[model samples]
Target: MIRFENVGVRYADTAAPALAGIELTVPEGELCLLAGPSGVGKSTLLNAVSGLVPHFTGGRLTGRVTVAGRDTRTHRPRELADVVGTVGQDPAAHFVTDVVEDELAYGMESLGIAPDVMRRRVEETLDLLGLAELRERPIATLSGGQRQRVAIGSVLTAHPRVLVLDEPTSALDPGAAEEVLAVLQRLVHDLGTTVLLAEHRLERVVQYADLVVLLPAPGAAAVVGGPAEVMAVSPVRPPVVDLARLAGWSPPPLSVRDARRRAGPLRERLAGCSPAPPRQVADAEPVAVVRRLAVRRGRVEALRGVDLTVRPGEAIALMGRNGAGKSTLLGCLTGLHAPTGGSVQVGGAVPHRTAPRELVRRVGLVPQEPRDLLYADTVAGECAAADTDAGAAPGSCRALVGELLSGVPDATHPRDLSEGQRLTLALAVVLTARPPLLLLDEPTRGLDYAAKARLTAHLRSLADAGHAIVLATHDVELAAELADRVVILADGEVVADGPTAEVVVSSPAFAPQVAKVLQPQEWLTVGQVAAALDGGR
Candidate 1:
């Protein structure tokens, strides 16, 4: 469906070409997984294929690019619209309509399809994506997942043979991410549509992909093959893969199911693989408190009568679907959003009532999108400026920044980095503030297992050091591993709140594989699950 022959693209402002002599092809109905560190021209290649590179972006293009036998240089985005459907990481940026059904119809209407055909396509797409219930809902009122689905559905209505998604699930909760992936699978299997998607959260989606494309960071070589081949040889492997390697297994498990199936023999081979005692944090003073909190965002009541408390040395995972009030609750806790009703207290003082400068010392927030925090030219500079006092050693800040960049996979351009890397950088900058309470919104989004594990370990250490953490995430495994408690919100209400095991395992949408495997045990983290499985073995 798509082909790039010696394709080189250079943006006017940049010294080097965004994409350098990229020779690639996408066969009809083939699902291709494009993997690369952020800013290595993954987006550039996609843009070229979709005719947005030279046409809309105004970049110099060299070499031939073809999609469905049509040359990209000659075709504009609108001209190539019927053959390809493109969705980017940020769905909100692409929204052209305010309503769901209208958004779906926008693409078809542009194609000059008959009104009857447009109506049918919109309805079918809504049903296919499980958006029939939300057809009348305002796009702005929808959750991150719902909005992404709408963006995809709007494009899919065009019945394009090829679908190219640039980290489509970056903003979605785990459940919503799964829904989108499931839709992608269905399209490839049932509808025979070609899919080419780029994502950093390889642990979740890699297993489902037929082929994997691993592009080296900035100045490295690109590798492509079946998922297993590429993932094994890649610099960083997922946790299960690492476990497999540690156990001396030939081929690593790609998914949790694969891990469980292969773990039996591996456990037998590695003796003394017993579970460690659960991490214990000593009781500490309360750093933040929220009681009967109600937060209103535009037309949506994001939080309704929610009560929660975070103590120093506690890592709390807030889980919910997109629009489940996770972000809103975080905003309320961080003083970014004032509670419409109820109260929020940081260090026994109301967050809103606290002075901004004083609040900087008590609480730090890393918003869901990392772009909000990045403005400096270099990663080192961004972290340095996050400090409250001028006397802090620049050497210490630079060291911390370097450590954070090294910890994440493919740390290149702060702006061009993947969602996961950006989140890590943002958190690293926030950490420079030395705030007691750290509020992370979807901190695990777009992270590979290794990156996620490293981050989880860091959060665990932070909690051990008496820093309270409130992480709004869709990752149940992360919650299980790092958070002492899990608070679930649905439709602006705190639907579930308890220990990580209890809340995560009980919630159908947010539960990870291990949680389902050990249903009654309520194990939230991979370590806990590994221990349980070790015991059973």
Candidate 2:
């Protein structure tokens, strides 16, 4: 169990407490979700639970915090490691061992568990998290989602009484996310383990939460209740809840099944109408081309006989399971990886063969690990350097960042920003080049619905202006909102590629919640459905 009594946190430089007068209790075996807008101190609250607030983070902690009756104020993270296991937003930062199997066992080894027990737990965790195939893969070679599973398995292997995760499923595809959440459910029901997580993708996890704690703003009082009660008033909610509100459904539904039950009348009313189609692709020559691309890394064939083409005014989403070659394909386009066979051309020049300066003008990439693209300590410094490197106007990157997420201070450290904010900064850096082709991997991992909407609008404008975009992501809702085409890959090959609606509107694994609720109708987003009814009215 976790308890926070009159708890507040303040850093050295700030006068106001990052968290103000928070009081809450999470019962043993219950899954407690920390919900709030970006930069609203969700991560700060999680750190408090795991004793990272005042201990390692160098922040002032007031009031009492306890986990499993152990006072975190007095206990350092190392002292509480047996009772608490924590996984932060970025998984790669937590790995000490280079190999997946070794990483999973590292936690238990530190805890001094018996070797036999550790081995058994490691195997169980690998199977539980669907990481059996990747057990021997190097942590460096694994995809972002693969690294996430390894991080979680490492934590689960320790068998701590309390589990704390920040955005645990952000990098996982739909199927893998379900597997991890199901494992959590089993832990809570079967073993009475406590789970505390902060996540932005509510649609994936809200239905499973035993309690929801809403921090409305940076210093707002905590609102604690059942999931439904909190979701009704929460500042950020999933598309399903939004649809319920728009249709006057009492006690808003949390899952797609429940919403579908109440959608009969609404569906009938819209039977005669159709949602507006996305922007038409302009008649232009191919901006980039991939022909029979085959990329081999060690023994793994990351891509095999894959083909794709992009044109100006196009937004394409590359989707697949973990290790399914989505990121590998994105790397190919950005010239990060050379193909073993076939050809890739962007702006009529081969990406892997193009000069560095020429590649900057022809193509740009915002990789899955947004931090990889960041080097400067301050936000303003980063923006200024981006402008200089790309020969763009001064303040161009800052203006683009402002459009994405407003109010990021110029002097703030890039490391201090949330995962969502870092991604925004990286995106601004890439867009500064104003290249003919743009590539983004997991573009919306940490962004909330509002920030994602802004991103959608901005990308839509770029597409309209004849810039080509490709997004390799696990966020199905994002694909529904922004992508003109959806290209799915599996086992390093393209499996499904078509218009966004046609590809995802009916698929069980890939469909967004709105589309799932209004199946057979090709409605992909809440905005589109609302606009359709509003137009009819």
Candidate 3:
């Protein structure tokens, strides 16, 4: 059980409190979802629950916060380790050991648990999180999704009464995300654990939440209730809720199955209408070409005999399950990984052979961990450095940042910005070069709906201006909205590649929420159906 009464938090040098007037309660044995826009203090609230707000973060905390009847202000994170397990947004920052198995057991060892008991709990957690195969892998060698699961397992092994997770499923594929959520459901129902999680991919978790907490904006009080009650008025909503609204369904469906059951009439109405056509680009030369591309990392063949091409003004979505070679392929494009065999060319030059200064203008990458691309102490410094490195105008990078994500202070440290804000800054850095080819790995990982929409618009404009964009992502809705082509990879090879609608509509796992609800129809988004209805009327 977690309770907050008149809680307010404000960092030094900030005019307004990051969070204010927050009154919330999470009952025992319930999974409560903290929902809000980016930079809206969702993470701040989670830190408060784990006793890290004022204790470690050096922020001013007001009022009372208690977990399991113990005041958090009195108990530090280490003091509450027996009852509270917290996993932050960045998984790599949480690991203390190099090996997967060791990292999972480190938390328990710190708590001074018996060796035999710790071993048993670690094994149980490995099986629960599907990490058995990765027990011996080095932490640095694991993929983003693998690291995410390991970070969660590291905490889960402690068997804390309360679990706090931030963006738990953002890095996971749909199937893997379901597994994690299912495990949480079991913990709440069978083990009587209190689970509090904040996630932006609402379509994956909203249906499973026992309670939904909506923080409309920074410094605003939160609204807590059933999923449907909160979603009706919440600023951020999942795709299924958008569909229910578009179809004029009363009491909007919270899950795909519920929406599908009532979709008969809407399906009939959209039967004669087709999904929106992909955007057209003027005929131009190929920006990049891969011929029989192959990459081997250690003993694993990360990519195998892959052939692909990107033309000017085109958008491609690289999609697949975890460890399916998506990131490896991106690495080759950015010259981060040397191909074991085959050839890769960007703008008629090999990326691996290109110099760093020249490559910044030819190609750019926004990696999964946005912080890796940032090094300056403040936001303004990073922008200035990007301009110097890219040989761009003095204000170009800052302008891009303002356009993509507004209200970010120039003087704020890059580390202090929220995950989404960091991502936007990284993107601005890459865009400053005006590279002909752009690659993004999981760009929507921490972005809320509004921020994601802004990103989509920016990418569209870039494509129209003759830039090639390729993004490796697990966000199906983003693919549906932005990708002109969908390429699915498996086992280091391309399995399916075609136009967006043709590829995703046929695959149940990759289909968007609207596509699932409007099955037997090919609609992939609420915007498509809304357009059809308006045109028909």
Candidate 4:
């Protein structure tokens, strides 16, 4: 249905091609996945298919591109609207309506479809994407994942043959991501719609991908194949694949379940791979304490009277499904949102009562969205700004910023940098202040495996250095691997809090594959699982 012939694209103001000599095709109804590290032209390729590359983006395009038998250069976005629906990473950036139902109907209405057809399509989309219950909810009231689904529903209602999504599940929680993926699966199986999606979280979506297109890092080539062929041969792969490879398992497992089922002599190979248990440092003094804290957003009570405590050197993961008030609790902790009742004390000081500058020294918070913290002309400048404050020494700030950029890419614009890089930079800035407590919101949202490893290492280092770390995330793997304790919140109140292994690895809401396989064992990390398998052997 779509084909790229020797496609090479270069954005203006740069010498390198974003996409280089790409030759590929997608048959009708094929759920193709474009995978690679960031800035390797996954988005560029998707944009090419939707006529957004040379048309809206104003970039140089070479070679021929055709979608549904029409030349992409000749077919404008409006002309190809009926054939293709594209959803970018930031759903908020593309929102055209404030209500859920209205947003779903906007695209069909714009195409001049009849009212009956539009309404029918909208209802079907809402039902398929499981948005019928939220059809009348305000877009503002919906959770991040719900809004993302609404974004896809709006595009899907157009009844386009091809759906191209750029990191559609990046902002969604695990359960919500499953909902979106389930809808996509239905669309492919029931409606025969083609899907070409670009996403960084390969672990969640990799197994379902029928065709995988692996792009090389900038200035390299692209690789494409079916699931087993691509995953086995590609340079980039999920952790399970890496484990399978390292353990000498033939027909490598794509998921942990398959690995367990196929376990043989390979189990012995993984026996000695366990990481050291995360230390549980004792700090009698709690740095931050929340007691009966209540937070209200508009008419909704986002957080009820909630209590949480963080002691120096303790790492606690605050987890919940989307809209369960994890972010609201973080907001209250960081003073971004004032509590409606009760109190929140940070580093033994009341958050709302302390000055913002004083809060900076006592507590560091990396917000859910990294873009809010980045606005400098260069990556270095953003780092510099993050390191320095009103009273911090300029020399000290510059030195810290330089250290932060040690592994970051050269000449890369912070805005143009990948999600993981931006996240790393944000954390580096937060760490520059050397606060006693660090608050990280959805810290692993867009990170790939390597970046996630680095992040885990950094967090471990921070905890080892006696810093209190509070992370609000849906990443069960990170929580399992890094956190010493887990605190689960539901409807703004703490529902569970205990050892990370008990609260996260064993909890129904966030159990890792290893935990599921060895349910009674309570293994959370790959290392732990490896040790168990080895000990069994």
Candidate 5:
């Protein structure tokens, strides 16, 4: 349904083209996945299919791109709205109306569909995406995952033949992500709708794809084939694929159940071996302390009597389902929102009562929306400003950004950059402060496995240097890699807190793929298995 012929995109004033020599076709009624590292033009390619690359983005498109028999070069996004629906990385930017119901119907209204038809489709989409309860809620009041579902519903309600989505499930929890993926599967199988998805979180979506198109390197042509074939050679892969490679299994499995079927011998080999325990922090003064904290936003009691303590040289993962008060607790630490009751302290000072400049030095926050930490028109400008604000050396933030995601130019605007690239930039900006306490919200939302590895190693080094790390994330693999402790929250309360392996392996909803595949064993990651095989453990 979508065809790219000799397609190459080059943004002005860049060292190399964002995409090069891309030639591929996405057949009708199939789910095609775009897999690649950060800053490799996956988002740019998705934009091209929806006629946003050259028409709205001002980039040069060097080939003919067609969707559903119509040339995107000639048919703009508005003209192709009936045939194609596009949802970008950021959901908040996609909404046109304040309320959920209105937003879902806005797309159908734009197409001049009859009011009755629009209402029917909207109601169907709301039910499909489990958004019926949020039908009348304001967009601004919803959680990150909630807004993502609403954004997808708004597109699905239009009943377009083709759906182009970038990171559709990045903000969603495991269950919610499964619901969205199931909806896409139904659309493809039952309705014969074509889906072209670009997602960094492959663990949730890779197994569901009919075909995988892998961009192995930046500016490289894509390799298209069956999901397993592409993943066998793709550097960016999920934990299950990594495990398959470590076990030397042929035709790597894509799902946990498949891997489990093939993991009998490996599990027996590991029967006598035990994974290393989580790091233990020594007795020391706490970096942040929260005692019986409560926060109420409007009519919702976002957080209720939560207690948490972070000491130096420790990494903690705050995990929960959507609207479980994870973000609210993070806000309390950063002083973005004051507690409704109880006491919250960071570096021995009350966070919400502390001064902005002084508080930033003690604690740095990389928010869920990375763009919230960015304002400059260019990457170089943002880096310079970060250096000035943090009193760090010149170009420190740029160096960090380069390490996290390579091939990002200094002149690229944060808005123009890919979601993963923007996130790395925000992380770099916060790292420049070298704060004692570092907080990240969904830090791995858009990061590929390779980029995520680089980030994990960097954060590990910081933790080793006595910096306390607290991450509010849904990426269980990330928590397995970096977090020494896992804290699960439910409805504004701390439900569980303990060592990473103990907390995650006990909960099926939050368990990583490796742990799920190798049950009865406490192995949290493929790296642990690899290390033991290589005699590193």
Candidate 6:
């Protein structure tokens, strides 16, 4: 059980408390979802539970916070290791070992558990998280989603009574995300583990939450209640909730199955009218061409004989399961990873042979780890450096940052910003040059709904302005809204590639929530259905 009474946290430089008067109680054996917008105190609250807020983060904490009746104020994270297992947003930062098996066992070794018990737990965790095949792989060689699972398994092996996860499924593909969520469900029901997690992808986890804790904004009072009660008034909502609202369904549905059961009449109403089709980008001039591309890392083949063509004014969504060569393909485009065979030409020049300085003006890449692109001490310094590197106007990068994510202080350290904020800053850095070709790997990993909408609009504008965009992502709803074409890859090869609606609507794994609910219909988003209804009326 976790309890917070009149809890408030304030950093040294900031005047307003990051969180204040957050009175809540999470019962034992229940999975409680901590929901809020970006820059909110969701992470701050989780830190308070694990005794990291005032201890590791160097912040002032007010009032009492207890976990399993143990006051976090008295016990440090190491002291509470057996009772609390905390997994932060960045998994690589938490890893101490190179191999998957060693990282999973490191936490238990630190706690001095019996070797037999540790081995048993390690095997169980590997099977539970679908990481049996990757147990021997190096940590650096694994994909982003694989790292996330390993980070969670390392904590789960400790068998802590309370588990605190920050964005546990953010990096996972649809299938892998379900597996992780299923593991959490089993822990809550069978093992009596208390789960307190914060996630931006509400569609994946909201249906499983036993209790919902809603933080409307920074420094505001927190709301706690049943899932439906909180979601009706919550600022952030999933596609299913939005669809219910558009269809005028009372007591908005919380899951796809629920929404589908109530969608018969609405489906009939829109039967004759088709949603407006996406703009045609395939006819535009080629911006990049790949002919039989292949990449080898060590012995593993990351990409295999991939033939593709990207054109100006096109928005391509590169999608597949974790470790499916999506990031590797993106790297091939930006010259980060040279193809072992075949040819890749961007703007009439080979990416691997192009000069680095000249490549900046021809192509840009926003990698999965946003921090990798940032090196400056402060936000303003990073913007200035981007301008200098890209040969852009003095204020161009800063202006893009302001437009994409507002209210961030220029003097704040890039390290101190939230995960979503860091990603936005890195995106601004890449966009400064206005490259003809843009590639982003998991661009909306930590963004909330509002932030995702802003990014979607900005990327759409770029595509319309004759920029070719290829983004590797697992966010299906975003693909439905922004991508003109969908390209699915599997095991280092393209499995399917076609127009967005044709590809996503036909596939079960990649279909958006609205598409699932209104099956036998071609609608892919709530906006599409809303437009159809208004036009019909």
Each model's lDDT:
0.75, 0.92, 0.93, 0.79, 0.92, 0.93
- Expressed as tens digits, the lDDT of each residue in 1-537 for candidate 1 is 778777788766565566776777777877899887655677777788899888887789999999899998988888888999999877878899889999999988888999999988888888777899889898877877778889989889999998999888777777677878888898899888999998876756888898877777652445768888887887655555655565555676688777667666644533444335545656666788788888887766778889887888888888777778888887776677888899888876677777877787788898877888888776656656655342366655555555654643222457655565677778777776667899998786666555676777777888888898998877666776787888888888887887766666666777765555334444444555455555766
Worst 10 residues of 3 by lDDT: 275-284
Return whichever of 5 and 6 wins on TM-score: 6
lDDT score, candidate 4, position 218: 68
Q: Write the per-residue lDDT of candidate 4 for residues 1-537, one digit (tens) a residue.
A: 889999999977677788888989888878898887655778788999999989987789999999899999999888899999999876777789999999998988888999999888888888777788888889988776777889988998988999999988877777778888988888888888999998777777888888999985764677888866778876667667766665677667776678777654554444444545667679669989998988888877889878888898999988887788988888788788888998999877888778997888888898867888777877667655764562455545445434443345435677776666677677766777778889998887666666677678877888888999999888887888888888888777888988887676556658865565444455566676556556657
Off by over 4 Å in 2: none
Q: How many backbone clashes does candidate 3 have?
A: 0
- Following a full C-alpha superposition, what root-mean-square deviation does model 1 have from the true structure? 3.8
Q: Lowest-scoring 10 consecutive residues by lDDT in candidate 1?
A: 404-413
User: Mind giving the per-residue lDDT tens digits that candidate 6 earns over 116-195?
Assistant: 99999999999999999999999999999999999999999999999999999999999999999999999999999999
- C-alpha lDDT of residue 49 in model 5: 94
Report how far residue 362 has shifted in candidate 1, in Å: 1.8
* Residue pairs in candidate 6 whose N, alpha carbon or C atoms collide under 3 angstroms: none
**Where is the poorest 10-residue window by lDDT in model 6?**
277-286
Considering only N, C-alpha and C atoms within 3 Å, which residue pairs clash in candidate 4?
none
The better-scoring model by lDDT among 4 and 5 is 5
The TM-score values for the models, in the order shown, are 0.87, 0.98, 0.98, 0.92, 0.98, 0.99
The true-versus-predicted C-alpha distance at residue 68 of model 3, in Å, is 0.7
Residue pairs in collision within model 3? none
Model 1 spans > 4 angstroms off: 9-21, 56-60, 266-274, 296-299, 375-384, 388-391, 395-398, 406-421, 501-537
Write the number of the candidate with greater lDDT, choosing between 1 and 2: 2
